[model samples]
Target: MKKVSVIVPAYNAHDTLARCLGSLVNQTLQDIEIIVVNDASTDDTWEIMSRCEKQFPDKVIIIDGDRNRGAGGARNQALDLASGEYIGLVDSDDYVAPRMYELLYEKAKEGDYDIVDSGYYQEATDTARLYTGDDLTGILDDNKRKKTYCRRRISCYQSF
Candidate 1:
């Protein structure tokens, strides 16, 4: 199985979808699959997904919903097709660091943990705050961090 399968559910996210896919396509760990679900988007989301599929035909899997399934349902749909050892979730509007999965995967293997979490940032016009993601970090400092209780996010999770 692939090392990790990243699931992304898109709904009218035409603006940032391409950039998000670009980051995943360029992940440091290449043994991963990106499953993007288009939840009946009324915008150009489908077209962008299609283009990304063409560009990364082997790694990117496209799922088109006939009707609106919302984010949860879209994710569930992708979950059914995922064939990776670990599962990773990414919002269509969010882009991750290139080494994000590499670090998380390494942690999972080294610690023999079912889950690994990472930190993320919330960016606005003038403010950027640390938030959450697969690494589920909230990690202020890798060396000095004592405890991180941010969001209930996981960098990746094992299905079994």
Candidate 2:
């Protein structure tokens, strides 16, 4: 089984952290580690995290930062501690489906891709849509994507 590292960068996100972590806990794929970067939160983030850590002691790894690191720096801290073959980034405020990692990991394993951007759907009250598109031909080719998005040719709304 392939192991995955799910990294979460948290600041004063006590309100949403539980919901985010709840989603991760219910994932179908069990071979994963949850890395939470506590970016010096002044709220009850650490308290909530303590309870969660006790509940999932074997699976949770909390990296407490002495000073507040921005999102990028917190993610870097988690990356340095990650030991899994695949690394996943999950914002502390956003929740994902239970099969998110399972499907992504399967696609990565089957396609032999160094990076795989999977398809997603927007769940709206009045509408829903399926997205299909060409993958990035190369990495760091901002001009190509920027031009496509700027020309209003991109299908997705968040085209950045």
For each candidate, the alpha-carbon lDDT, in order, equals 0.81, 0.73
Deviation (Å) of 92 in candidate 2? 0.5
Number of clashes recorded per candidate: 10, 0
Error of 2 at 101 (Å): 0.2
Return the TM-score for each candidate structure.
Answer: 0.80, 0.79
Strongest candidate by lDDT: 1
Q: What are the per-residue Cα lDDT tens digits for candidate 2 across 1-160? A: 2377888888999888999888887888889888898999999888777788889987788888889988779989988888778888877876777888887778778867555544334444334444334544345378755743454421112201
RMSD in Å for model 2 = 4.7
Model 1: lDDT equals: 0.81
lDDT of 2: 0.73
**Model 1, TM vs. native:** 0.80
RMSD of 1: 6.2
